[model samples]
Target: MNEVVHTSPTIGSNVEEIVFVIVVVDSTDRERISVTREELYKMLSHEDLKKAGLLVFANKQDVKECMSVAEISQYLKLTSLKDHQWHIQACCALTGEGLCQGLEWMMSRLKSR
Candidate 1:
C-alpha cells in the first residue's frame, strides 16, 4: 500500500491548504493491511494534519479477491475516527471507477469546513 498525501486548493481561497489526506491502498494485499493502518494513524496524527479529512481509495476493487470497501474501512479502524471526516471508496485505477465520488466527497468536506 502506498500512502499518498494530497493537498487541494480551498474553495474560493487563494491559499492552498491540506484540507484532506488521501491514502491509496492496494485492496488485494491483505497482508499489508495492518501496516497500512498504522501508517495512516501516524500520518493523520501529525500536528500539521490534525484536522485534515481522510479520503481512502481502496484500489484494485476489480480483482475478485480484493477486500470489500466495508472490510477495508473496518480494518483501517475508520469508525474510531470520531473527530475526523472520512470516506472510503472502492475503485479500479484501470477503469477510473469511484474516483470522482471520492473527489466530490473531498470537495464537500472542504466546503463544509
Candidate 2:
C-alpha cells in the first residue's frame, strides 16, 4: 500500500511519485476545512504531483452538525481542481462507515490509471 502521511501544511517538495493522496477533514469544523483546502491546493499544485489522484474524506458524519459531502465540496471549491481527478466521500470513523467505499473508489481510479 503506497501512502503519504502528511502531518503539516507544508508538504515536502521532494515528493517523487505519488499514487494517491487521501485528505481527511473534519466535517464539523468549517475553519479547518477552509485551511485544508488551501493546503490541498498548495500540495497539489506542485509540478511533480500534478497527476496524483486525490480523495477527500469528509469525516465525522456521525456528528449532528457536520457538513455533508456536497457542502464540503462547495466550501473547498473542488471545482477549481478541474485538471485533477478528485472525489469527496462522507464518512464516520467511529463506525467505519464509508471507509471501504472511499478506499474502493481510490483503488478503482488507480487501477484505471
Candidate 3:
C-alpha cells in the first residue's frame, strides 16, 4: 500500500489519498521557502491529510550560501506540524547526494504506518 502524491503548492487542495508528500525547496531562497512552508502547512492542515508524511528536501546544498537544515527547519517552523510525520534532508540533486536517504526515510515511515 505504498502511495505517493505529487502536487504543486498551489494545487494541493485538489488532490486526495496522499500518503506521502515530497516538498523540495532551495536552501538559499528565504522567500521561496516561506511560501512553500505556508503551502505545505495549509495542505497538511486539511483533515484528510492529517496523517500524510512529509519529506522536506533542502535542495542546492552544494551552493556556498545555502542555509543549514536546522535553520531551514526553524524558518519553516516544521516543529509546528504536530499532526503529521515529517523529515528534513539536505540534498544536492545534480550529484545525487541525500536523495536516497530521504526516499528511504519516507518508505520506512510509510511501511511502519
Candidate 4:
C-alpha cells in the first residue's frame, strides 16, 4: 500500500500513514449516543481518511441496557458511508469477547487491499 502521510502541528514532524481507523463506542451510554454518532460521521467525512477502513466497536454488549449492534449502526448512519469499507462489532471489553473478530475483519480488509 502507498503511504498516506498525515501531518499535524501538534505532533510536528511526526507523520504517520493511516490505513484504517477504529472507533470504540460505549453501547450502554444512551445519553452519549448522539455525540458518538456525530463524531463518527465527522471522522468518516474527513478528506484525509477517505480511503481508510472503519471498524466500530459497540462495546459493553454484556450490559442489559446496552444498545444492540443494529441500533447503534442505524444511529451512526453507517449506511451513508458508501465510499468506504466498514464493520461494527458487538463486544464486551471486560470478557474480551468479539475483540478478536473485529481485529480479524480489519486484517482481512487490509489483506484484500
Best by lDDT: 1
**Over all chains combined, what TM-score does candidate 3 have?**
0.79
Q: Which model scores highest in TM-score?
A: 1
Clashes (backbone N, CA, C under 3 Å), per candidate, total: 0, 0, 0, 0
lDDT of 1 by residue, 1-113 (tens): 69899898767757767568899999999999999999999998999888889999999999998899999999999999976789999899999999999999998877776
Which is superior by lDDT, 1 or 4? Answer: 1
Give per-residue lDDT, candidate 2, residue 95: 95
List residue ranges in candidate 4 displaced over 4 A. Answer: 1-18
RMSD versus native structure for model 2? 12.0
User: Per-residue CA lDDT of candidate 4, range 7-108, in tens?
Assistant: 866655766565789999999888899999888778877998888899999999999978999999988888888988999999999999999999999989
Error of 1 at 18 (Å): 4.7
Stretches of candidate 1 above 4 Å error? 1-18
How do the predictions measure up, each by TM-score? 0.83, 0.80, 0.79, 0.81
lDDT of 1: 0.92
lDDT of 4 at 82: 90
TM-score of 2: 0.80
* Model 3 poorest 10 in a row by lDDT: 9-18
Q: 83 in model 3: Cα distance from truth in Å? A: 0.8
